[model samples]
Target: MPTDQIDIERYHQLALQKQKEHRLFLATLKRKAPKNLDKIVQEVHTEVFSEIDCTKCANCCRTLGPLFTEADITRIAKHFRMKLPVFEEAFLKTDEDGDKIFQSMPCPFLGEDNLCSIYDVRPKACREFPHTDRKKIYQINNLTLKNTLFCPAAYLFVEKLRERV
Candidate 1:
């Protein structure tokens, strides 16, 4: 199992690099200025994802809660071979807005290596981790900022984008 602690110097360096990249991306977006931002964001997401690897930074699993949908519950429940009710009682609960989420911080499924224990059958939200590719990308400004600590890639993406703008 890999340790969760990232080298402070290396982590900071990478974070700064990512920030720079985000600025560049934003600058390009402003210059080219896509017809529809939603589609453009997805395209940029695909391109950025091709360049940046998430496995190298599993901060999402370490921080933040994934808003679980009903399907997330049923599939994850099946992954454990337990009824949805049993799984919910064991590892999940409804938050203030009726969204099902993990009981506490640091996902329970996160293994020592920063890999999800049930990666293949993980929740829909987990499958869509680092959801920069989605249409409502701008709406998740809060999430993108929060991901800075957990995902160096996100920091780089945003930083580079800002530069482009």
Candidate 2:
């Protein structure tokens, strides 16, 4: 879908309105999801993402901070030719969960064109963002619910999965 076709404000409002319903649905799904649930979700994820250009809707990069593992920190720091401590001091902060995350919204690596400057070396969490296509779809229902608020592709994946299963 075109970026213009995606009304992000409308999605946010709709997601809020349906939050309870979606939560209950996910809880129920977690308890009794279909055996093919992962396959179905993967199909939906592929279909939704194929149509939606993420570069046009970098809301994830703009609004969400991905957790950076030690390996991720090391790799990214190496990419910048900076020491780990310097990189951490410059761009990272410890979140409530003790996970290291970017210090601010709109990730520093995000370019003006809405692409990741370090796409190849981006953190594992970032690389697995929205995570709609992961195996055992029911295991990450909570994450998926949160993602719907930020990722149009994730929202569409859930909607499509509802229709499918």
Candidate 3:
């Protein structure tokens, strides 16, 4: 769907309205996930992404900060020719789980065009945003549920998954 066609407010309302049902569905799937769950998720992910252009939305970047691993810090620091400590001090903060995350929302690297200025060196978590195609998807039911609030693609993936499996 085109950027203009994505109604984020409507998505949020639907996701919230269906949150309890989605949670129950995810719990059931976790207990008896299909043997081909990964394949099914991958197929749905492909179909959803083909239709939703992320650059047009960028809601994940705008509303959520990606967890930055040590390797992610090293790579990004090197990309900026800065020391890891300096980079961390400037852009990161430790979350309650002690994971490093960007200090602000609408990520500093997010350009006015809704593109990532550091796309080539974005964090591992950023690279895997939404993570709809990951293996053993039932393992991250909670994460997927949260993502439905932030990503139209993630929301659509779940909607389609419900229809398929």
Measured by lDDT, the strongest candidate is 3
Q: Write the per-residue lDDT of candidate 1 for residues 18-110, one digit (tens) a residue.
A: 655544454555466656777656666676787666655666776677888888888888888999889999988889898888898788988
| Best-matching candidate per TM-score | 3
Ranking by lDDT: 3, 2, 1
Extract clashing residue pairs from model 2: 1-51
Which model is ahead, 1 or 2, in terms of TM-score? 2
Model 2, span 63-164: residue lDDT tens? 998999999999999999999999999999998989899999889999988889999999999999899889887788889898888888888888888888
Model 3 lDDT tens row, 1-165:
554656777888889988998898889889999988889999999999999989878888889889898999999999999999999999999999999998888799999888999999999898998999999988999999999988888889889999888
Model 2, position 160, has a per-residue lDDT of 81
Residue 13, model 3: lDDT of 87
What's model 3's TM-score? 0.94
TM-score computed on alpha carbons, candidate 1: 0.70
Model 2 CA deviation exceeding 4 Å by range = 1-5
For model 1, what is the error of residue 127's alpha carbon versus the real structure, in angstroms, after optimal superposition? 2.0
